[model samples]
Target: MDGLGFTVDQMAEAERRGRLFGLAGDVLQWSGPPIHTVQSAADELGLSAEEVARVWALLGLTVTGPDVAALSQADVDALATWVALKAVVGQDGAYGLLRVVGTAMARLAEAESTMIRAGMPDIQMTHTHDELATAQAYRAIAEFVPGSGT
Candidate 1:
């Protein structure tokens, strides 16, 4: 029962229960000031609607709005964290990070299976030597620009 050790069964159960976010519960406790709208929340902290959407999906929450006008602050903060992590992946261009995020996300059971989905066309094209370096650059911009709060 040590804080750091979990049996495979325990980990599997956690994954089944969508407890990946709760794994970081100490850091994720609701200690910040309240936020009411998604856009304002994103604006206050610097995030994008797309980033927010992905985070909400990860946290077992759903956003129901036609636009930025209908978003909650809590959702925004969580989205910010997701954006940060995603930004890191893009910055490094290390597929390992992408795999880690995808694995963690898989445990959350929130999003679709990324492996089944295709990689970015740019990545695919570059992977085929169509434009490899540009593929990395394209990935960095597409993912980080929205997530980095820039």
Candidate 2:
């Protein structure tokens, strides 16, 4: 049987990686936690679909169909963070963050995707989420402080 672009060795490596990541078989067939559709997430966050889309779009995300399952837990957290940011920085500052941060992250993801498609090594799972978050917090602070990391 023809295997298209995937050789037996490549398929084996994929299986090994999937097993290591606790993922079963295909991404489509994987039994995993529930992610949210745009509409459902809006309902959960008590926001209008238009509002959610506006914010999510600022982050370079476009959800065309309401039933499209696209959002993860981090996206949910982002919505909550938006609420907190509004309380702290008011409306304009919060939206500004959505535009700046979203664009930056989307660009970063594009770069990462390009490297990965060019066969960069698999992503390392060295830092726990907590450790990564703490490191990111420090890095953001250092970037903000003039001549700190320079």
Candidate 3:
């Protein structure tokens, strides 16, 4: 099967094994430049396959398309930043981060593809992960903000 198909298969396997909740990215060993295998991405980020899969599976959408052959370096970096933010934020942190980053990442991917479709504009979704990480941190703090003793 092609790379996108293979990625779906891997995701299914992860879900079946119940490791989907703890996916760590290195489960696939992807070597291609743009298409990152789960295992390879995990290794690159010093994360476990289980952790990567877990985080990945939490997304409401499935990643597909030629542009999604491998996790772009930019996306991979963003995911790593999200994970690091998760460290200090924990479960609630993850919830907020996922909600925000997941949507932003999706938009960023769309924009990237648009650029590619529009003759490869020099603009790219860079450092979005950092922006996502910051958003998560802010959300965590917001949760604690005093609210009229509601």
Q: Give the RMSD in angstroms, all C-alphas superposed, for model 1.
A: 16.9
The CA-based lDDT of model 1 is what? 0.45
Give residue 103's lDDT in candidate 2 (0 to 100): 81
Tell me, by TM-score, which candidate is best: 2
Q: CA lDDT, every prediction?
A: 0.45, 0.58, 0.53
Write the residue-wise lDDT of candidate 3 on 1-150 in tens digits: 123234666567656865432222222322224667667778888888666666676664444432334566765787788778777788687867677766875676576446443552221223233433433333333343233111
Determine which window of 10 residues in candidate 1 has minimal summed lDDT: 21-30
Which candidate number maximizes lDDT? Answer: 2
Model 2: per-residue Cα lDDT at residue 104: 81
**TM-score per candidate:** 0.30, 0.52, 0.39
Q: CA shift at 127, candidate 2, in angstroms? A: 32
lDDT of 2 by residue, 59-133 (tens): 777775778776776677769779777889988988998899888876765764465435422222243334334
Off by over 4 Å in 2: 1-34, 118-150
Model 3 lDDT, residue 58, Cα: 65
